[model samples]
Target chain A: MSTTNSRMSRKRFSEPLLGIGGILLFLLVWEAVPRLGLVSARFLPPASTVLVQLVNYLGQASFWGDVGQTMFSWALGLVISIVAAVVLGLMIGSSRFLGRATHSTIEFLRPIPSVALIPLAVLLFGIKMESSLLLVIYASFWQVLLQVLYGVQDVDPVADNTAKSYGLGRIARVRYVVWPTVLPYLMTGVRLASAVALILAITAELVIGSPGLGKQIGLTQSGGAVPEMYALIVATGVIGVLINVGVRIVERRVLTWHPSVRGEGIA
Target chain B: MSPLKRIAYFIGLPVLLIALWWLLTLGPTNFFVPKPLKLVETFWTVWASDRLWTDFLPSIIRLFIGLAASIVLGVVLGVLIGTYRWLRSFTEPILEFFRAVPPPVLVPLLMLLIGINDQMKIVVIITGAIWPVLLNTVEGVRAVDPVLSDTTLTYRITGLARLRYLVLPGASPQIMAGVRQCLSIGLILMVISEMFGSSSGLGYTIVLFQRGFAIPEMWSGIAVLGLIGIGLSFVFRGVEGRVLGWYHGLREMQRDT
Candidate 1:
């Protein structure tokens, strides 16, 4: 038993170490290729150079401004969508009638890729922060709303009826019965939507030329700051990594009492 | 839930919204906000124009080619990763990092590397589309029935034959789901890549119209994109249904029992 426990502990510790080793090996290969003159270091700047530039950018206020603007749009859009989706999702999801009424509209609106609506957004609100907000809110709304609808549909009919029979009011039944069932789905939807919100926020910046890291990337790339461009790209990627990890952590915490969370990813 | 009532309810909201839009925009507004009727006319004119044929085909083709390439790459790479335990653990962080990088953000780098040609656009699409399929394929491969693999092993079956008969079929349903997701992402990247310095595709045309201040035409362009999106997904669903009919049958049967 002791030996088995130690083996398990060692295996657990080694997994992330293995991941780190892989990234290190990747960096080494990246560093070696440019140094070997196989590929021009100009186009694919050495990983070391990119890292140095990234460190330099960390000291710049402009970099933080870009990061802050991107995060602000992401957070604002996500919050708006979550609020909109939850309220509308709850209202629409509460009845078979409401769901059916909105079926055609939702189906039509859902597949209209938010990016494709860029020109429309630009038309309504030019290349501004509001454009990013529009795209982000539109895209993320569908992601969460659909999940919430599914959550509502998944509520046990018997439990709901029992709550009603126990003289619980609409708000109480929602609090005790509906919220528990919907919470898990909400968390999952939120986790998925958070990534999407960030994507749209950056895409809006990149395509619409709104202010953010994406705009900075385009500016640097065109202005002959290749390493800085790559560094900015890496910064976006790091933000992406942090967001994914953050979402997953928040999800686990929120859904700690849920069996599904405990049983995630069998292999 | 009468059929007539259901039909009325289903169509009512959208129709009302459209009417409201047409009504609200009846008076003159900004040049950008054209009446729906005018926009529809513009859309009709644009669709009938020769550029629609020229621009639409390449974008659609890029979407398919990139999606197909990614599906192939993903399934192949995913199977290898799933089968090899050590490699899976080692590659997880790299994959996760790459996955987080928004697909559009890679466009500039790809454009520099490949030039702003169809090839560049296609490569961007592949980069964007690959992650979903690859991750799904890995998950699917891992979820392949243990009994099937054990049986293959016990029978001394190995390599290609085992993969074909056991792993592929078991993982196919998931692979199809991944393919569906890849289609959407592929379309997105196709537009985004074209939004770069490239001059030929729907994205280019839309941006051109907007910058040129062809507001009605620009509106039409966006409408057409939405049509294409809806059309493609509907087609994809039809194909998914056909391909995964057996899997669906098995699931339904299991549910019954």
Candidate 2:
């Protein structure tokens, strides 16, 4: 038993170490390619140069301010979308009549790419954070709303009927039965929306020159500071990965009772 | 509610929205929110001048060329990776890294390297569109039933024959989904590439109008693009439904069981 426990511990530790090692190998190759001048250093700078530039940029106060603004807009947009989608989804999902009535309209509007409305958003909101938030909300609301609808649909009909037979009111039935089932889907929606919200926020900044990481990258690129541009692009990539990882952690914590996670023993 | 009443309720909301928009802009304090009536006028103005068609055609041409190239390349590479375990393992990380990098971020670098031209726009669109299809194709192929694969092998099917007869059919549903996703993404990238640095296309027209503070004309340009987006998406959905009717029937069977 002691030997088996030790073996499990060793395997657990080595799994993450192997992943880190693979990542390091990739960075090593990236660094070496420019050093060897296989590609023009001007176009694709060494990883070391990008790291140094990233550190330099991080030291600036404006960098933090821009980051804060971007995060603020993203959070605001996501909150608004989550609230609106959940409420609307509940109303629609609870009523077959309503859902059928609105399905066609939803189908019509859902496929229209939110980014295509940047011009309209810019005109309406004048390149402010409002514009960015509006675009993000537009992009993310449908996804969450659909997931919530599906979640509500997936609720056990027998459980709902049992609650109804117990003389529970509509609200109570939803609280006891519907909400729990939908929570996992809501979490999934939020996870998916985080990536999308980030993309829209950055795209909004890029197109309209709103103050964010995207604008910084665009400025650096046009100014011919290729290394700094690459560094900022890498920073954005890191931010995306970090958000994904953070969301996954939250999802695991919140969804501990979910069959998919519990059955898989993912903690 | 009855079906007709339900239809009315849905249509009523959008009608109300349009009415409110028109009412709010009736005596607009700002030019940015042009009255809906004036927007119609601006649309006709552009339409009569033949500018819309001239600008729209080039954009459409670029969109199709980019989409076709990406679909071909993505399917070929996705198949190679999906079929071969070693290739999949080798390329997975690199693909993930590139997928995380936003396509618009690559526009400037691509422009600098390849020059600001139609080629650059097409390349950006292709890069943007290819990832979704490639990833989806890989997933689709991976999800194929092992039993069916073995059965095909037992029948002496191998290589291209196996792929054509077994893998491709099984993966068609997901591939179609990927294609639908790519179509819209390709359209957006087409516009963005043009807006950022190009002399032609609807994006350039909108940017020009916006910069000049031609609010009515800008709104008109935006409206045209929105209509195009709606039209293309509808067409793609029609094609998808036709192609995936068999899959839908299978799904119904599974659900019934």
Candidate 3:
């Protein structure tokens, strides 16, 4: 047991180092390919050059503005969708009639790719932040709404009945019983929605010519600023990594009492 | 629980919503929100003709090609990496980085590198759609029952036989989930790619209509896209049912107890 524990600890410690080594090896290849003229440096810039451009972007106020714009739309759209989904999911999921009534309609509408709404968004809002918001909300809304509905359906019937038998009102029962059951599912929804929201946010800007990192990427590509384009793409990747990490951290913190999180460290 | 009640509940909301839309846009004053009847008429006129062959077919073909490529590449690489612990650890960060980058961002990059062509569009789809399947396959492979693997080892199972009989079946459910995600992501990337510089696909035609103020026609394009989305999902469900039928049966049997 002691040997196995030590071996597990050793493996865990080396894994991150292996990951860093992999990244470094990738960077080395990225640097070598262009430097060797295997592919023109004009198209695929050396990693050093892109990194320099990324550093330059960090110093620029306009770059921050673009990041701010993209993040703002992502956050606002995600919040709106979560709020709407939670309220509606609770309402629909609690009542069998409402759930049945909306089932077909939801199924019909849910599969519609949100990017297909870009034309409508452009027509209504015309490349403004609202256009991005529309796409983001449309895309992320279904992800959370479905999860919330499932979460509501997952409420323990025995506990709910017990609450009722103890003279709990509808509101009280919902507050104490429904909310806890839904919290973990809701967190999962948020994590999923956050990724979708960012994707739509970037996509809207890329297609609609809105103000964001995606647009910056487009402009750089169009203007033949290859390194800058690569830099911006790298920046978006970093943001994506950060958002994922942030969501995981928040999920752990918010769901500490949940069995999934509680039993995690023991394994 | 009655069939009549079930039918009503299923179709009632959609019918009522369509009726509400028809009533709300009854007049000829609102150009943006075309009447439901007008949209149906426009849908038939625009999509029921040769544009179906030229625009719709090509978009679908590109989507499928991209999806097929992604599935093949992702599954092959994912299985290889998943089979080996050292390889899995070494590639984890790189895969995560690639997956994190929104696939749409690849559109401009690919357009520049590969030029504005069908190849670029397909590559865009593959690049973005590949991640979900690859990542999910990795997780799925890792989750395969250790006891089963030990049994295979004891029986001297190896190579193609082991992969076919054990690894593939074990990872299939997760692989299906990834493919489901890949389908949607591929569709999105398809539209985004065509929207960029292409002139002959479904997305381009829709943007053109929107640009020319062919409001009803653009709405028709969107409607067709939605129908395609619905159709793809239905087909996916059929395929998944076949692939995961045993898994589902097992789950149900477990639940029965």
Identify the leading candidate in terms of TM-score: 3
By TM-score, the candidates rank as 3, 1, 2
Whose lDDT is higher: candidate 1's or candidate 2's?
1
How would you encode candidate 3's per-residue C-alpha lDDT over A1-267 as one tens digit per residue? 999999999999999999999999999999999999998998999999999999999999999999999999999999999899999999998999999999999988988999889999999999899999999999988988999899999898899999999999999988999999999999989998999899999999989988899898889988999999999999999999999999999999999999999999787
Report the CAPRI category for model 1: medium
TM-score of chain A of 2: 0.93
Evaluated on CA atoms against the true complex, candidate 2 attains a DockQ of 0.34
> lDDT of each structure?
0.89, 0.83, 0.93
lDDT of 1 by residue, B1-257 (tens): 68999789889999999999888988868676789888888888887788757998888888889988999999999999989888999999999999999989899898777777888888999998999889989999999999888999999999999899888888889898788767767877787888888778899999899888898898888787788778878998898888789999999999779
Error of 1 at A135 (Å): 1.0
Q: For model 1, what TM-score is found for chain B?
A: 0.91
Global CA lDDT computed for model 3: 0.93
Better of 1 and 3 by DockQ: 3
What lDDT is reached at residue A236 by model 1? 91
**Candidate 3 error regions (>4 Å):** none
Error of 3 at B86 (Å): 0.7
The two-chain DockQ for each candidate, comma-separated, is: 0.76, 0.34, 0.88
